[model samples]
Target: MRVLKQVLAVAAAGLVGSRAVAAVQDDPWLTLLLGTATAVAALLAYQWVVRRTERRDVTELARAGAGTRIVRGTLVGFAMFAAVIVTIALLGGYHVHGLGSVTGVVGLFGFMAAAAVTEELLFRGLLFRLVEERLGTWLSLLVTGVLFGLIHLANPDASVWGATAITIEAGFMLAACYAATRTLWVPIGLHFGWNFAAGGIFSVVVSGNGESKGLLDATMSGPTLLSGGDFGPEASLYTVLAGLALTVVFLGLAHRRGRIVPRRRPVDAPAADVTVS
Candidate 1:
């Protein structure tokens, strides 16, 4: 029953967000506000359902709040993506063109911020956490990660390889962040920062979804394997490698902290109450 609620909650969130975004596609700022609003509403719904159905305290999760962990996580995400950009630059795959406009900057930032929060709330806070309760850690991670990647196929220039890249890089790493910090805020921050830096700051294509411009006016050139083609630098092998490295670090930290959920075995029912009927 709890599992059913979780599924319903996630589906409801997707509907709310998709519909809201569609309604305000013309105004980037509106899209941003509505996007965030949708995420918050979805979160409340999730907590309400979980608390009512499972009888668990939702206080701790809320009390965790968006604090220093969020800041640090955002910075870490930026740094990792920076490393990818730098690698591509060194390889002569990227070039600086000029500066971007104010409107462009804010648009991308708001869009990405909304996207980050929405995705983290749905994927980590709901799906991964709920699934872990039954499927355990590794299996939950794999399932959520694949779904995350598959969903990205809806992006503008998405491809099989791009989806695969997103699955392995983002899906697992973000889940690991939740495991390590035991909160959704960190992963939300991480997602926001990565997207903002890539799309808003660096003026690059993000996840093949679309492009955004900011301070740096740059363009990607060279092989798709390195440049990530139309799917953007996110498809670059560098991103995959960096994401995997982060996943290892976060997962190791979570394991050391004893946060990884162990697989549970089913207990046999009292051998069917034995014979005398």
Candidate 2:
């Protein structure tokens, strides 16, 4: 029933999105912004309500150090951006230029911010943790990883191999990040960095659609394995490998501390009662 509710909610959101897109066909930017905002807001609102009902303070979500977490997250995200720029420059001779370039940067940031909060909330906060409550951390990580990759099937440039690779690689990596750190912030930064660097800097389709402005109008001069063909960097072998390596490193370091109450717990019990039980 919980799974059913989640599926229905996603489907409803998709339906609303299609309608919104059709209604705002004349203004692409406005449409994208508004639709994205609406979806994000709705998701946040729903989650907020759930947290409230559970008597869980939403602010007490992540166990990662707040000030340090933000700094580290932002740094990791910026590093990802730098890595992409370096990759593009090495492969396709990309470069940043002009005040005009800032527009693309800002737009990319907007998209990243949206993606960070929404995707983290969906995957880490709800899905991953839900599975964790039932299956334990390792199994939940695997499930969330596959689920994350599967969710991208509707993307314009998504391909079978790419999607499969993402499921096995990026999905697992992200789940591992969340599980290890017990914080959504790190994964959110990584996600934002990966997308922005790949699309906003390299002038490639992030998942499928081309970015507003990027360093180079790259023509993938190599095979699909080298250039990710249609599914973009998220599906690229390099990204998969990189994400996997990072996940390992993060897992090694994370203390695995957080407030994830297990399923079938006595909700009404006091702290002392909980310990006694």
Candidate 3:
């Protein structure tokens, strides 16, 4: 009941918020406002539901050092994506034509912010956390990671390989990020940073979404393996490698910090009394 309630409440907020943002995409300012509101609504919904259901504070969103953590995570996320782009460029898979629209950047920031917050809350905050209690850290990561990837299949340009790449790069790494830090801020920042860099800075298609006119008039070429084809650089081998590296780092930290949870063994059912018939 707790899980269902929390999921439903937050999911509703996210759904409505995303729709509102989409409705106002033509107006950058309105999109930004609605996107910001959506993010806030999702957070508020999470807080309210958690309080009612678990009778505890949403400690994962504690305000202490939140800004610093978010900034740090954002920087790291941006740097990682930048590195991937640079690598692709060096390999002649990417090119820069000219500057893109500044307005696009603003709109993208808003859209990506809402997406990052809602998704992190839904996947890492609610699903992974609740499932972790029963299945433990490793199993929860696997389950949530796969679900995250599968959900993206609904995107316009989604494919099997694209979904697999997303599962490995984003799903596993983001969950591991939460497990390591025990907070949603880091993963949220990281998610936003990566996405913003992809669409807002590079003007590329994000997560198989349609074309984005961001800060740069950039184009991609070369092999699909290198350029990520229509699914974008997230499907590239570099992204998978980078994500795996981060996953290993975060999971190692979690293990060292004793945050990894072992699977709970189900209690044996009481043996029924067998009277000789």
Candidate 4:
């Protein structure tokens, strides 16, 4: 019941916020305003629901050092995507034409911000955290990661391979990020940075959402494996490799920090007797 309540509350805010942004997408100012509001509302919803349902504080979203964590995650995310784009460029798959709209970039920042926060809250903050209590870290990661990929299948240019790529690249990697830090801020920042770089900076189709008028007039060509074709660079082999590398690194950190929760065994024992890791 606790998990269900939290999920529904956060999901409701995310859905309503996304629809509002889409409805005002044509107007950059409105998009930015509503997107920011939506992001805030999502956070509030998560905090409210957690307190109401579980009667516990949301320490995962504590404000202490949030700015630093988010900034660091954003920088890492941008650098990772930039590296992938550079690799594609070297392979003759990517090219930049000229500068694009500043307004478009502003709108994309807001849009991506809302998406990142809400998604991290729903997926990692609630689903993975709650499930991990029962299934352990690895099993929860697998379940939530697959669900994340499956949801993206609703995108316009989605495919089996594309969904699979997202499962590995974003779903698993982002969850691992949360596992390592034990906070939603890092994953949220990473998610925003990656999507913004893809759509706002590179002017590429983001996760098959469609053409984005961003800061650069960019074009992609070459094999789908290298270029990611219509589904965007997120589906590129380089993205998967990069995501896998991060996942390994974060999981290693998690293991070292004793953050890896083990599967709960059926026994007649006190809850306090069970040790994590």
Candidate 5:
């Protein structure tokens, strides 16, 4: 019931935010700013709802309630995506060109900021966390991750392989990020970094959402598997491998930290010992 309430809160916040962004579409800056404000507001509402319904600490809903760790996770996400784009450029699969408009960059940042926060809250904060309690870590990861990627099918120029790649790569990788730290901040940061880099920095087609100008104009070429074809670099084989590598790293860290949620067994809970008064 708590989970359900949280989901409703997130949805309501998102709906209001989307409408607000739409109203300000004429002004990119305002739109981005509004989007961000609404996203944060939504998350706060989600936390409030969870606390009210479940009487849970709610700090975990806010990423372990640690500002430092939240910042660290965000930076790590940016770095991970940066690594992928950098590797692609080094391989000659991506060629960078002239600088883009400052407005474009800022707008992308705003849009990405909103997206990263809201999506992470919905998928990782709500879905994965609740699901994990019932289904265990690995299965919840699979379910939520696939749902994450599958949802992207709505993006323009999306393809089967692209969706599949997202499922295997981003879906698992982002979930793993949460599992590692038992928080959503890192995954949100990672999501923002990946999207911003794809659409705003490298000037690639982001999940086939058409080309949005970034800091640079990049001409992407090479095989469909390597270049990700019409869908963009995210659909590339390299992207999947990179995501897989991170998933492995984060999962290992989580396991070592004793944070990985184990599968529930059919056996009943052991009875508490009763002592004579």
Candidate 6:
């Protein structure tokens, strides 16, 4: 029955995803917000139905607080994003946008929020947790990262290399952040910052979804390999290397914190057959 419930949840999430893609065909930013709202609503409805029918709570699967956990997670995630941007800037081949106008700044924040919520709920919340439960930690991380990249395959300017880079780089890094923090806020904030800087400030295509201009426009001329082709910095091998390094660092921290431990379920003796001897 638990397995059936998990399957149902995944199916429902897929339905929401289909709607999100269709909506994105409109204005990318607006669609992002709309899709996110729709997904949350749909999931709420599904949860309500499941609870009513099965008399079970879903919280046990992916439990975390709504207050402090989110705040701390987001702050830590912000630092990670800052580090990435700094690393990119130091590496050259990229320029950041300067907010010259109020409108542009507002628009940038809007895009950031919408994209953060949408991607976090889908990727970090549903997909990651679902895979983790069935495949164990490491395998789930790998599979989810690939899924994240594959989802962008149909984006306007996405390519095979771009998708592969995203799968191993941005995808893995974000997954590690979530796993390390065990909170959705960290991944959401990381996603927002990366996109905000890469596409909004840098004026790059965000995974081929949309183009954004932040305070300053970042121009990347050089070779496509250095510039990440049409997909953005996330598609570059350099970004992949950086992301892998970060992953290793986080994995080390996780190990030190004893995050990697054998999962166990306490065996409870079959409830004494009340009616039987």
Best by lDDT: 3
Residue 92 accuracy (lDDT) in model 6: 80
- Cα lDDT over the full model 4: 0.92
List the candidate 6 regions with Cα displacement exceeding 4 Å.
Answer: 1-92, 96-101, 261-277
Find the 10 residues in a row with the least total lDDT in model 3. Answer: 263-272
Steric clash count of candidate 2: 0
| Model 3 segments more than 4 A misplaced | 269-277
| lDDT tens digits, residue span 1-277, model 6 | 6545644664565466555645553455554555456545544644554566557775522445644554554565445545655655677856655544334545555545555655666666666766676666677678888988898898988889888888877678777777776666666666766766565455666776656555566655445566676777666666777778878876677677765434333466465467955
Q: Which stretches of candidate 4 lie over 4 Å from their true place?
A: 268-277
- Candidate 1 lDDT over residue span 77-151, tens digit each: 999999999999999998998787556666566567667876787788878987898789899999999999999
Per-residue CA lDDT of candidate 3, range 74-160, in tens? Answer: 988999999999999999998999999999889888999999999999999999999999999999999999999999999999989
Candidate 2 per-residue lDDT over residues 203-227, each given as its tens digit: 6667665434644545444456545
What ranking emerges by lDDT with the best candidate at the front? 3, 4, 1, 5, 6, 2
Candidate 5 to truth, TM: 0.89
TM-score of 6: 0.70
- The local distance difference test score of each candidate is 0.83, 0.61, 0.94, 0.92, 0.81, 0.63
Ranked candidates, highest TM-score first: 3, 4, 5, 1, 2, 6
**Which residue pairs clash in candidate 4?**
none
What lDDT would candidate 2 get against the real structure?
0.61
**If scored against the real structure, what TM-score would every candidate get?**
0.88, 0.73, 0.96, 0.96, 0.89, 0.70
Our model 3 lands, by Cα RMSD against the true structure, at 4.2
**Candidate 4, position 266, lDDT:** 66
- Tens-place lDDT per residue, model 4, 1-277, is 7788889999999999999999999898889899999999999999999999889889999999999999988998898899999999999999999998899999998899999999999999999999999999999999999999999999999888889999998999999999999988899999999999998999988888988999999899988899898898888999899999999999999999999999998687556756678
Residue 156 alpha-carbon offset, candidate 4, angstroms? 0.3
